[model samples]
Target: MNLELLESFGQNYPEEADGTLDCISMALTCTFNSWSRDGHKLVSASTDNIVSQWDVLSGDCDQRFRFPSPILKVQYHPRDQNKVLVCPMKSAPVMLTLSDSKHVVLP
Candidate 1:
């Protein structure tokens, strides 16, 4: 990942940009979300417990969802573009519905 490219996304610190790249690479998750239906948005979850939705065209964060603990992994719902499944350290996996701002704990 190019640090310069990530820095363009409003990252004020080099460490943060590096962390974002690490998360994207480690997770191998979708950098582009289908939520936009236009391939103009992306999502990334970092160990810092923040899930961010980004605007691909503008290089801005569309929204950020924070959790109580460090995140272990993140997965998006296969069909629900507005939803993401996050596994937090020492906690149950949660289903976060972005559109409605609902957090559901999975058993």
Candidate 2:
């Protein structure tokens, strides 16, 4: 299967709280609780421990990021969009480098 990133402003719906937390690709049922804009690109986070990036012109998700814990909010660095701030519900916010996923600077 192709692993292309697909994300954008998605409408959310309520679902039964099952025994598991989804951390996979979000179809239309994913609800974005927090979001931030970086030029023409959009970055958003949800309760599914996923962070997705989308192109504004086409409304297509270009990439999806995963975290160990559920994401509460996300923000793009003011100077560099590649550097993202991921705030988890149970942990401190981390500054992640999208290119390598190596950095974990404390927030």
RMSD of each: 14.4, 16.2
The 10-residue segment with the lowest total lDDT in model 2:
29-38
Q: What is the lDDT of candidate 1?
A: 0.71
Clash numbers, per candidate: 0, 3
Residue runs of model 1 more than 4 Å from their true location after superposition: 1-38
What is the C-alpha local distance difference test score of each model?
Answer: 0.71, 0.72
lDDT of 2 by residue, 25-73 (tens): 6564344533444368777776667888777889998778777887767
Clashing pairs in 2: 5-61, 6-61, 7-61
TM-score of each model, in listed order? 0.59, 0.58
lDDT of 1 at 69: 80
Error of 2 at 101 (Å): 3.5
Report the Cα lDDT for residue 14, model 1. Answer: 59
Error (Å) of candidate 2 at residue 79 is 1.2
